[model samples]
Structure formats: C-alpha cells, structure tokens
Target chain A: MKRLGYLLGKDMRLLKRTPTIVILLALYPALVAVLVGLAVGRPPTKPRVAIVNQVPENKRDIRIGGKKFDLDKLTKALYENVDGYNVKDPAAALEEVKSGDAVAAVIIPEDIVEQLESSSSQGTIEAIFDSTDPTRKAYVENTIKGLLVDTNNELTNRFTDVSLDYINIIVNGGEITFGGETRNIEGLANGADLIKDVLPYVPAQQRKDLQEFAALSEGAKQGANFAKSLLRRVGQPIKLQNKPVGTNSSLSSLAVAVAVAVSAMFVALLLGAGMLAYEQEDQMLTRLLRGLAPRSTIVIEKTLLAGICALIVGTVMVLAFGAFVDIRWERAFLWWPAIIVASISFGAAGVMVGAASGDVRAASLASFMIGLPLTAAALVPKGAVSDGLYSVLQVINSIFPFKPSLDFLRAGLSPGFDALWPGIHLAILILAYCLIASFAIKRRVA
Target chain B: MPVLEGRDLVKRYDERAALDHVSFVVEAGESVAIAGPNGAGKTTLLSMLAGVTTPDSGSVELPGGKLGWVPQKAAVYQKLTVRENLELFARLEKVDDVFGSATRMMDRIELAHRASDRAEDLSGGMRQRLSIGMGLIADPAVLLLDEPSAALDPLQRERLWELLGSLADSGIGIVFSTHSAGEVEGHADRVIILDGGKLLYDGAPADIGPGAHFELAFINFLRARRAHVNVGGDAE
Candidate 1:
C-alpha cells in the first residue's frame, strides 16, 4: 500500500512537471464552464413581431354596454408586452418578416373598433409568420395568439352587452340565476348538476327563453374551458417544474453536470492513456516492471493517478460552473458519488486503451476515438442530434458507463428525487469497468 | 556461490532459434562480457538472464534480490528531474530511504550538480549515467545491460567500463553484451562469444588463439560451426 502511494505520488509529480498536460487539465474545464455559462446563462431574447394597427387615430373609441373603451390604449398595451414594431404599410410589415427582421406580422383590420363595438360579431386579427424556422415561428405565433386572446377577453369583460357574472356563477360552481330567481349551487360540481337545479324553478313563459339561453351558455362555457386547456397545451408541450431544492434553476444544474462529465472524460483519457503510452515511449515501463513492484501495482498506481486527476477536473468544473452561473449546492453533496464514479470509470477506460495499444501514439488515437463518442453520449443534448440518431446514441450510451453516471447526476439534481437505485446501478457499472480494466492489465501488460 | 545461472536455454522464434542450448554462469563478483555480431542473440540471452522474459525450454536460477536491467535505450522519464527519476525507481524497488538512494546515485554519477535538471535536458553520456545510477539504486546482486555503451563516445564508454569494474569489485555480478571485442579485451574477466544463437567459445579474453583480432576470430568461429552443422546433417 505504501509503495503504491509513493508510486502514485511520483506519477502526479511527473504530471505536474509536464506543462502541456497540466495546462490542458486546468484549461479544459474552465473553458467548459465559460462555454456553458455563455450557452444557457441568460434568458432567451424575445422574438420580434411587426404590428400593423389599421384603426383610425381620430376615432379611438369602441362603444359597448353603453360604455366606450379606448382602442388605441389596448393596442399600445399589447405592443408593449412584446418586441412589437408598428408599421403603417402592411406590405412593409410582411417584407420585414420575409427579411428575417421580424418573425411574424400582426395585421388588425381597418374596422377593428367598429367590429368590436358591433354586438353581432367578434373582430378578426390576422397573423402572418415566417416559415423559415418552424420552431421560431411556433413560438412567435403562440405569443401573438396569447396577446390577442387576452385583449379580446378584456374587451369582452369590459363592454359586453351581458356581463356574464351569471354565466360565470355556473362555471365557477357558485350560484345560478333564472326567471328573476337566484339559488346557491355550491354543492353542485358539474354543468349538468347546475342545469338540473335551475330548470325546475323557471315559470312557463320564461321557460323557453331561459332553457335556450342556459343550454347555449353551458355549451359556450364548455367550449371556452376546452379552448383554455388546448391553449395551455399548445403554448408548451411539456411542463417540467425544476423544484428549487439546490440550485436556482434546472439549466444551471444541467450545465454543471455536462461540464463535469466532459472534463472528467478528457482528464481520464489524458492521464490514463497518455501516461501509459508515455511510460512505454520512455522505455521506463520495463525498468519499473523489473523492480520489486508487481505489474498490477503499476496498473493500479497509474489508474489511481488518473482517477485523482479526474477528481480534480470534475471538482473544478462543478465549482467553476457554480461560480460563473447560479447552481444549487444544497444537494451538491448528493452529486459527489456520481462525480467520483465518473472519474474512475473514464480513467479505467483510458487504462484499457493504453494497455491494449501498448504504444503512446496508438493509445492517443484510440483514446480520442473512444473518448469522443463516449463524451458525446453523456453530454450531447437530446435534440442536438437527429431523432433517429439520438435514439441510437441513447441505446449505445446505455451500454456504457458514462450514461449511468449521467443518470445518477441527473437524478441527484432533480426535485423530489429520493431514489438511490440509479446511483447503485452506476456504482455497479463503475465496478465492472474497474474489474475489466484490471483483468486486461494483468493479462495483456503484466 | 553462483549469483545467476542459466542451463540449456532454448528460445525459438517460429522455426529459427534465437538462443539454442546456451549455458552460462556468473559468480558473485565476476564481470562477464557477451561478444557477438549484431543478430547473434546477445540481447535474447541477456533478457533470459534478467528474467524479463521466459525461455521456451530452460531453467534460469537467481537467488532473489534486485536484478537490475538497463535496456539499450536510456529509458528514464524525460520530464522528471534526475533526482526525481532516481527517487521513483528507488520507491519502486521498495528502498527504505528514497532520498538517500537518489543522493548516493547522483553523487556517484558525478551528476549531483545537475540533479534538478530534466532527463531530456541531459547530454547523451549524462543520461546513460543516470540510467546506470537508477540500476544501482536498488544495489542489485546482478545487473544485466544490453549494449550499454552502444550509444556512448569513446571517452563515455571508458568511463562506463571503469564504473562497471567498480560495481563488479563491490560484489555485484555484471553481465553486459558488446559488439566490439576490443571493449572486452582488458575490461572483462571472462568472455563468451556467440554465433548463430549457439555458444562458440567461453574463456578468458587472452585465450582466443594467437595473433587474431576478435572480428576475425568471430568469422572463423562461424565457419567452423557451419561446417560442423553441415557434417552433422549429412550424417543424419
């Protein structure tokens, strides 16, 4: 044990004496932290939308329910909430969208106030989108839809002929009114239940009008509820709530995790494969083997040195990520096992490559050939690769150690995360890598 | 007592034998030189003696202590300082005092002044001396060197011989291979000549017949061995 410790210390000393390797070990993780900070640090910029309001400047009022609502104020308010530029010419607005200066254009018809004032129909607003980028277009369209919907709802609530407090009563499961009679319907939970409670109290003459209005109102309420649900689904397909248990947000957590994994892999490969090959090149390996130290000692000491380097790189990456960006350290302790396992597994892989090649140049090429895909497997975001390719990568990744390490990291960062199963699985994978590496070292190099 | 012994060693590569039925012994304080042509299997013999590789069919006996091997290439860590390199080997050898061993080697090689210099920065002769110093750190019972002076200048080779003589005098068996018979003429206590992986002669350096240089003697030896092999084949 003491001999191994001294040998490991010597390896570390040799590494420290190597300037290029030392610089790479320190710089790679620092660069990763900065890159991650740059990539996902700030909130995404708002998309530009061109708004062409055709309502006359002189006539800015829409009369409804014996009250006049300011049309100009509503339009100004909507534009303020978005990166909306006002353009007079509709052609110019469309041209801006075509030129990529704006993602979409909102064209309000010239008689918007007249239409809003008309109790017969709702106003129509047309939105034209640039189809160059479908994802950007979808985001822009949803934003515009939301803004317009809110405007329409505000107008409906303010100046409608009927203030649907009565209709809202049924929707909200509060009270119902019909035939100048009101009844509390708090106990009822559904539309049908409310209708059943109210239908019996209506007089014969008012029955026909009340029944028709009730049925129409109930249907409108149901349609509105369905639309609200649909709008939510359209706005965001998945709602992942990053519970603030440790870091301020999930982006920071993901960035840190990826940085650690990437840096750990490189450090491992550099120390494991690079060092092994270096020993061979120096012809010092045979001399070392000719001594009292066993071949297993050499393998173990090299691996331990690489593992130490990996731990240093991993810790630095995580710390730098946390320092440069907002990350939760409350559960930072939970992530250590994953970080340590990642270092060891990746280091063992490097040892395997080095031992197998038995040449530094060959080991270097092999390390890169192996490290690149494995690092990608752990750190590449899902959508970054094509759907088909990503699925294949996922399958390939699952068969390796990095994926389990990443899984363990992700589970640690997640909210309400109380499971230790992934961590145990990762530990097992790391153990397997170590065992295989030891066996290979003993058989091939020993 | 014999510090090292190998008997009837036969190492074959495919159908060709690298070393065939070669037998030799080294006593506690003997300086043995293996003299041969380039492909005469001196290195193969040295490898077996050093226990670096196993012979196909031979028993090599060594009463265990540090058995040092200095390969033809000066294989020290180029990045590490001379002192650090020695310390590393000392640690590997499980030497109780790594610093003491390193210091002793540095002083003995007359490289104590450049102890802090990286091995890569050292000159060829100094690097070779460092390699030898690393071998001596463990105080080996027998040191096997494969063409140790092959890369050295005449002055460096002379200095290396003087060092090897001192090591042998201090009771460490020194077995080294050389291409030049002149290198072993006066320095070596015993000479073993090999031709075609077979031992042609083993005796004191002065007993190789009269008025003949080592190269000519080696040619004559190969001719006699080949004629003997042909005669045996015809008889068979």
Candidate 2:
C-alpha cells in the first residue's frame, strides 16, 4: 500500500508538470457537454417553405353553404405558421426545394376552391420536400400538415354554422314562399291539428288518415332540431390535452447532458493508456518492476490515477452543461459515485489496452477505436436501430459502463428514478476490467 | 560468497534462442562488464538476473533476493526533481529512512547541488547518475545496468565509471552491459563476451588474447566464433 502511494504520487507529479495534458483532460469533455447542451436546450430553427398559389384573383372568394370564404385566408394561415415565401408556380416552388433554398414547397391548386365547394371532391394541395435530408424533410412535412389541419378545422366550422342556420329555420317554424304565396310553417302544423280535432265527428276511417298527417308534421319538426344539434358538434369532436406526470420537461435535457458527460470516459481511457505507455517509453516501468514494488501495485496506482483524472473531467463537463441547461445541482451526490466508478472502469480498460498494445501510439489509437463505438452503441436509443441491432446494443449496454453510468447520472438528475441495477452493473464492470487489466499487465511483464 | 548466480539460462522466442544455456557468477566487490553485439542477449540476461524477466529454463540465485536494475536509457522520472525521484524510489523500495536515504543517495551520486532541479533539466550525465542512485537506494547486494553510459560524453562517462567503481569497491557487485571495448578494458575487473546467444569468452580482459589491443582481440574472437559455428554447422 505504501508503494502504491509512492507510485501514485509520482504520477500526480508528472501530471502536474504536464500542463497540456491537464488542460486537455478538463477541456475536451466540457466542450462536448456545452455543445450538446446548446443543441438540445435551444429552440428549433424554423424551416423555410415556399408557397405557390395557383388560384386566380377573381375566383379567390367563393361561397360555401351561402357563406363567403376566401382562399387567401388559408394561405395567410400557412404563411403565419411557417417561414413562407410566395412562388409564381408549382415548378418554381419545387425548384426552390430541390435547390436547397427551401425545405419544402406547398402548392395550392388552381381549382382548390372549386373542389371545396363540390361535396363529391376534396381539395389536393401538393407538398414537395428534399428527400435527401429525411430529418429536415419530416420536420417540414409535419409543420405544413399541422397548418393545413388548422385551416381545415376553420373551414368545417364555417360550413357547419351555415348548415345549422338552415336547420334552425325549419325547426323554429320560419315563413317560406311556395308558388308565389307565403305560408308560415307553424300555421300549416296548426291547420293539420284543426283537421285532427274535427276527426271525432267524422267516420273512423277518416280519423285514422288525419292522425297519420298530424304525426308526420311533428316528426319533421323534431328531426330538424336534432340535425341542428349534431351539426354544431361536427367541427371538432375530440380534443387532445397533455398531462405530464412526475418528471420535469427539462429533465430530458439534463439526461442528455448526463449522457454527454459520461462519454468523457473516453478521455479517461486515453489518459490511463497514454500514461502507462509513457511509463514504458520512458523506461520507468522497468525500473519500478525491478524494485520492491509489486506489479499489482503499479497497475492499481495507474488505474486510480486515470480514474481521478477522468473524474475531474466528468465533473467539469457536468458543470459546463449546467451553464447551458437546467441541471439538478441538489442531486449531484447521486451522480458523483457513478462518475467515480465509471471513470475507474474506463481507466482499468485503458490499462488493459495499454498492456496489450505495443507502444503509446498503438494504445492511443486502440483506446479511441474501442471507446468511440462502445460509447455510441451504449447511448443510442432503442428506436434508432433495428430490433436485432438494438438487442445487440442492449447486451453491450448491460455489460459496459457507458449506458449504466449514463442511466445512473440520469436517475440522479431526475425524479422517481428507481432500480439499483446500474450501480451493480458498473461495480461488476469495474471489477472485471480491473482483473483483466492486471492479467494483461502481468502477461506483458512476463 | 557470490552475490549473484545464473545456472543454464535459456530463453527462446519461437525458434530463435535469445540466450541458450548461458551461465555466469558475480562475486562481491567485483565490477563485471558484459560485452556483446546487438541481439546477443545482454539485456535478456540482465533482465533475468534482475527478476524483471523469467527465463524459459533457468534459475537465478541471489542470496538476499535484493537486486537493482538500471535500463539502457536513464529511467528517472523526468518531471520529478532529483530529490523527489530519489525519495519516490526509496519509498517504493520500502526503505525505513526514506528522506535520509534520498539525501544520502543525492550526495553519493554527486547531484546534491541539483536536488531541486527536475531530472529533465539535468544533463545526460546527471540523469544517469540519478537513475543509478535510484537503483542503489535499496542497498541491493547486486546491481545490473544495461549500457548505463550509452548516452554520456567522455567526461560524463569517466565520472560515471568513477562512481560505479567506488560503489563496487564498497562491496556491492556491479554487472553492466556495454558495446565499448574501452569500457571493458579500463573499467571492468572481469569481462563476459556473447554472440549468437552463445558465451564466447569469460575471463580477465587482458587474458582474452595475446594482443594488447582489446578491440582487436574482441573482433578476432568474434570471427573465430563465427568460423567455429560454420564448422559445427558443416559437421551437423
């Protein structure tokens, strides 16, 4: 144990003397965290969309169910919803999208109003998007679709209001003109009732026919009232409301920050591997091995040194992310242990790599190659990959420290995070990696 | 009593033997020089004796099991000051009086004035001295160095030899590997020559050949060894 302290002290002095390494160890992870925070924390930028209106000015204003509607109103709503600019024709709008000047093009057909007026036809508004960039294309498509849905709801509401007014005229007994003679609907119903009252003096057969006529008059009035009520609800029947439970909306950003911070283990791995390789290059390992210091003590000291360096980097990254995003500073206690264990795990893995590699350059390249892909695989969402690939990633995440460390950090930062599995997972990984590193070091010395 | 002994040390890398059935012994208060061409197993032999490496089929006997090793290059921590390097090694070697041992080693290596200077700031000779001091801090019975003065100038080499000679005179057996015949002739009390994983000669440097020039004797010995190997191969 005393020897281990001496070795660690020597490494610390070495690290203190090398200013560039110390700076890189702290800055690399912090930069990654800051960049990721800015990406997910900031509001999304609006996509540029081209609007092509093919309708003539004269036919722009059309009547639907005796209510005047303007096609310009729909286009105006679209313009308000997106970063829109007018184009002369569909070809020009498509050209804008294809040339990358616009993310999408919305083409309003010349006969859109005619299609809306005709009950048998529906209007077709063409949308063109640059398919090469699927993510931007999907965003633009959804934005335009949302705008169209709102406009469709408004048009449906206006038509329903007009239809309801006509139903009201029938149900409330309004006056109507037939063959140049004006007659009240209530007066006709009363005349039928008068006939029914006279039925008691007539024969039984005549009474039956009068009863049927009275029934028909009441049924027509009741049906019109029901139709008016149903038409009023036709505009919108379902409303969606979101009720978030337990977790804050900003917690996702914190989770992202944690993931980015945990990735700093790569830096730790490089430091650990590079330190060992440097010892070998400088012939310090040979000297230490020749002394009374045991091989295991050397390995442990190097692993701890790497872990300590990584822990500093991880802490800095978290703080850097806190500058850009909402971080739960109160929950830092929960993540500190996780970061420490994870850094040690990566450090041990780095030692193993350094032991197996031939030199400093080989060790550095190996650390990057192993750390990058494993880190990415551990953090990639299940939905981002195929089921087979995701299953493979799940195995990797289960065994490696990256995903577990990220989960542990996220749990620390958010509310209602349960399950103590990640802690155990990281513990097991640290032990396994440390043992492997020791074995590799022993083999190298042999 | 012998401070270090090796019996039939044989180390093979696949089909090539780095050291084949080599054997040697170093007595106390003796300075022995191991002279060899490149790939002649000097480092391999030294490593085995220091316990840094294991031979395929040999046993190294050190009475106290305390040995010191200095690699071909000066292996001091460049970032650490001379005193710090000494103290660190002393602590690692489990010396009871760490501070006192370091101070004594600094003075013994004639680097006491530069105790606070980082090893990297020191000249090649000073760094080598520090490295040797680190090896000596444990008070080992035998010290093994692989070309300790390989990077030193004439003055530095002379100073290094003087320090090593004094250490040997103080009853610590010193064994060092070198390619310089001058070092073997002037500094070594005994010499061992190796070529092609075989021990060519082991005796006093003056008694190796009839000639006065040790370099000519060494070249001629190598030629004779090659001729003997060729004749043996023809016989096989």
Candidate 3:
C-alpha cells in the first residue's frame, strides 16, 4: 500500500498548493448566506372579499311574474356573517367582479324564496363567479353549491315525506267452513337491499335519479315506513374537507428552491470530477501509482478526499440557504457522510471517464451523462411521476451514490418515510463506491 | 555481494520490443555507466532496476529493503521548495534527522544556498543535485539514475562526477546511463555498451576505452555485412 499512500500524499500536497477547493466550497457559501439573509422577504398571509345582495327592497311584498312572495329568510342567509352585503346598484356588483374586488357576486331575485316553499323545477338563480383563478373559482363554486344543494334537498325531503305513496296487496285469501273461521290475508314487503347496496357507488348528485327508479320498481310492493327509514339512514351526503395539505405559497416556493439547490450540488460534483480528470490528463495518476504505495491506499485516499470535499460543500449550502434563509437544518451531520459517498461516486465516475478517454472533455461528458438523470430525479417530487416511474427511479438512484442520499436532504426538509431509508441510501453509496474503486484498482489500466 | 541483479530481462512496447533479452548485474560498491544508442532500452533497463516499471518477462532480486531511483529530468515535485521535497522523501523513507540529513547532503552537493528555492526554479544541474541528495537521504543500497548528466554543462557534469565518486567511495552501488562514452570512461568503474537493445560489451572502463576503435570497426563490419551480395542476386 506504499504506492497508494504515496499517491494520496501527493494529491493532498497538490490540493494544498492550489486551494481552489477551499474558495469554492467554503467562501462561496458564506457570501451567499449573507446575501440571502439581507434580501429575502418574510411575512404572513390574509384572505378577504366583498358580497352583494340583489334581493329587491319590496321583496317583503315582492313581485315575480305578477306574483308576490316574502324573502326575509333567504336574504338573512345570504347576508349573515358576510364581510359586506350591500343592497345597491346591480352594476356595482358587476364592477366588483370586473375589478377582482370580490370572489363572487350573489343575486337573490324576488319570489325566489317563495318558490322554495313549493315543489317545482322551474326556478332559476344567478350567482356570477369570477373566472380569474381556477383554484379560487372552484372554492367559491363549491361553497355556494353546497349551501344551495342542502337547502333544496331539505325542502324536497319535507315535501316527499308528506306526499308518501304506497300500495296494499293480498298475497293469499282462503275461505274455510268451520265452527269458527276467520278471513286470512297476507301482506307483501318490498326488497330494497339491492338498491341500498348499489346506491353508495353512484355520485351524490345522481342519487335522486336512483330514488325515482327504485320507487317505480316498488310500485306494486311499496312500503312507506321502510323507505322512510332508508331515507333517514342515507340522507346525509358525505363531506370531504378538500383543504390542501398546507399553505400553498410556502409549499410551492419551498419545493422550487429545494429542487434548484439539489441540482446545484450536481454542478459542484462536476467540478470535483473535473479536478480528478485534470490529474489524469497530467499523468500524475501514473506517477503516483509508480510510487511506494499500495493500490487500496490510493483508492481509499481518493475516496476520503472526495468525501471530505463533498461534506464541506453540502454543509456550506445548507448553512447558506437550507438552514437560515429558506429551510432550516433538518439533518445534522447526516448529510456529511451522505455527501461523502456522493463525492466518491462522482470522483469514481470521473476516474472511469478520464482513465478510459485519457482526456478532461470526455470525463466531463461522462459526468454530464450521470448528472442529468440524477438532476431529473432530484428536481421532481416522489409522486410527481407515476408509481412505476418512481419505483424505477428508486432503483436507478439506489445504485447511484449522490441521488439516493438526497432523500436524506429531502427528509430533513420535509419529514417523511423514515430515517432508516437514508441509511439505506448511505449503505448503497458506500457499497457502490467500494465496488467501483476495487474494480478500477484491480482492473488493468493499459 | 552484488547489490542488484537482473537475468534474461525482456520488455516490449506495443507489438515491438524496446529491450530484447538483455541481462546485467551490479556489485555492491561498483559505479556502472550504461551507454546505448537512442531507442536501445537503456532507460527501460534503468527503470526495471529501479522498480519503477516491471519488465514483460524478467525478475529482479535485491537483498534489501529499498532502492533510490533518480529518473531523467529529476521528476521531483517542482512546486515544492528544496527543503519540502527532501523532507517528504525523508518522512516516507523514515530517515531520522531528515532536515539535518537533507541539509548535510545539500551542502555536500553544493546545493545549500538553493535549499529554499523551488525545485522548478533551480538550474538543471542544481535540480540534479537536489535529486541525488534525496536519493542518498535513506542511504540506499542501490541508486539507479537515467541520463543524470544529459542536461548539465561541463562544469556541472564534473561536479556530479565528483559527487558520484564520493558516493561510490561510501560503498553505494550506482548505475547511471549516459551518451558520452568519454564521460563513462573517466567516471564509471565499469562501462556497458548497448546496440539495438543488446549488450555487446560489459567490463572495466579501460577495456571499453580500447574498444572505441572496435566500435568503429564494428559499425563498418555491420554495414558491410548488410551490403554483401549472395548467389541469389539479392543484397544480404
């Protein structure tokens, strides 16, 4: 191993002479951290809007097609707890929608509340929703839709309960002559278990249509009490909270920044590889091997050197942006080993490149081939692609040293799957790097 | 006892051979000078002896721990100061009082004043002195140099010869290659001559001193042999 030790000692001595690595890994981060602390913005969030009520002033004695009805209850539901509901010009409500001042414009027409007291499908209402953003638009539509559906469904259920229809049928009647005989009659009960089973799978809005179909099927055997019980049991529509995981703005900004930072580390890896390639081109590698050192020592020293370099760079990046500016330091010193593996992986990658081609440009090209795919894996989230795709990426990244350990970085940023997984990532890196180093050393160079 | 020996050594390059079944040996206190035409495998043989490059098919047996090799052009770290280069070799070789030894050797070779200069900044002769100083730090049993005097001026060459004479006096085996047959005759204990990767003569410098005339005759004999006519009407 004298030869390897000699090579490593030479490399370290060379590194000390140049000191380019110190500037890049250490100084750059310190500068970036200072800039980020000074310039980045910080604040909280708030949401609001304006509501307009279009109910007529004479709605207490309102007219709808020469018919008058009371509208007090409807107006109260529309105006209660709302930020600001004004009974003013309809044009001003339209202006609110145009100027983006309001999320939506609600108009409660005259006699609309009166029509709600009876069973008829001929009533129309207008609630103009702004179409600027689909997310806000969907939010307004769903909220308004929920209220209207509940009110209409309540009124319909009340009407249907009073108008309950049924039929009586005699299954069998037999006349018997005896000392004392009584007329015998039997009643038939409807089978509705099938409808109940199928009803859950259909959409909530389509449940009313199914109700009519079931009613028709039971005309000859309708039972009022059982149907009433079914309605009471399945009456409440399922509610989904639909609220997104966290504050949308922060989540997105965090995601984008993490992706960029991860990709930037690849660039750092490329620079390290380029340094190795330079040594190869200069014939220093051969010179080192010819010295008094073993092959294993040479490989270990190189790996250690690269690992240290990567740790320094990764820590700097975290200190600059990951910790103070954007995301806090989630994994302490975990990334140190992880980055070391990544560095070795890249260094070995470059050795293969430089050794094969005996040139720096070819080495860079080889590194780029590796960097591009890992960059893609890091940029996208776990579920951003398909399950099959994510599985394939996991396999690819398992063999890759840098790509897998990034999961630890991801975990540090957003707590996830398990910490044990980073260990897997680290183990894979070490195993893969050792395998490559052994092959390179054991394999014939010429 | 002989300090370095190689038997039936052969080294090849690509499909061609640079050394063809060459063999030689060195005694413990002898200073041997190797002379060869360009491409005659002198450097290759020196490298094999120094354990820098292994031959295609050969064996080197040295009853010792280490050998010092001074390749052509010094091949030392140019960025390092003279003291640092010596210190590094001293550290690796486990030479006690390395700085003291380095300074002593540098003084012996007249490199004391330039000890602080970067190796690259030193003159060719000064660099050669620095390299020899490094080679001697471990008190190597065998020292192999390739073209040690090729780039030095006449005065530097004489100075190196004096140093070599002193080293040989101290019972170190020195094997160096050179193109100057006269220099070999004056400085070397034994002169070995190579022609087309073959060793033609190996003996005392005085013996080869007379063979300078034989070298001319040999060249003529070889030319005439190539120019001979055969019964088949083609030049042999």
Using TM-score, give the best candidate's number: 2
The candidates, ranked best first by DockQ, are 2, 1, 3
Q: What would the per-residue lDDT of candidate 1 be over residues B1-236, giving only the tens digit for each residue?
A: 68888899988888877788999888888988998766677888987776655688988888645578888889888888999889888877778898988999898888999999999999888999999898888888988888889899999888888888888888999888987767788678888877668887888877765547755665566566767763121100
TM-score-superior candidate, 2 or 3: 2
DockQ of candidate 3 is 0.11
- Write down the RMSD of all candidates, one decimal each: 9.1, 5.9, 13.7
User: Model 2 off-target regions past 4 Å?
Assistant: A40-61, A70-80, A83-142, A156-257, A260-263, A319-333, A415-419, B10-17, B56-58, B153-155, B195-200, B209-212, B222-236
**Which 10-residue window in model 2 chain A sums to the lowest lDDT?**
A249-258
Candidate 1 docking band: acceptable
The list of candidate 1 runs beyond 4 A from truth reads A37-41, A48-82, A86-251, A323-333, A359-361, A378-395, A415-446, B10-21, B35-44, B55-57, B63-65, B178-212, B219-236
Best by lDDT: 2
Kindly report, for each predicted structure in the order presented, the TM-score of its chain A compared with the true chain A. 0.64, 0.79, 0.49
Candidate 3 lDDT over A1-446, as tens digits, reads 55455556765676677677556555655665555444453432222234444445564553332234345543454444244356365677788867877666766556555555434644456677786788988887875665466445544454444333211222122332233564443333333445657988989999988877766555535444455556554545465668677423345234423442443445444544555556455433433344544445555565556555555665565555545455544444444444454455555544444344445677668778877777677556677899998888878766665555555545445544344666566666555555564455434322
The two-chain DockQ for each candidate, comma-separated, is 0.39, 0.55, 0.11
Name the candidate, 1 or 3, with the larger TM-score value. Answer: 1
Model 2 Cα lDDT, one tens digit per residue, A321-344: 777777778877877776787788
Candidates by TM-score, descending order: 2, 1, 3
Query: How many backbone clashes are present in model 2?
Result: 0
Please state the error at residue B136 of candidate 1 in Å: 0.7
For model 1, state the Cα shift of residue A115 in Å: 14
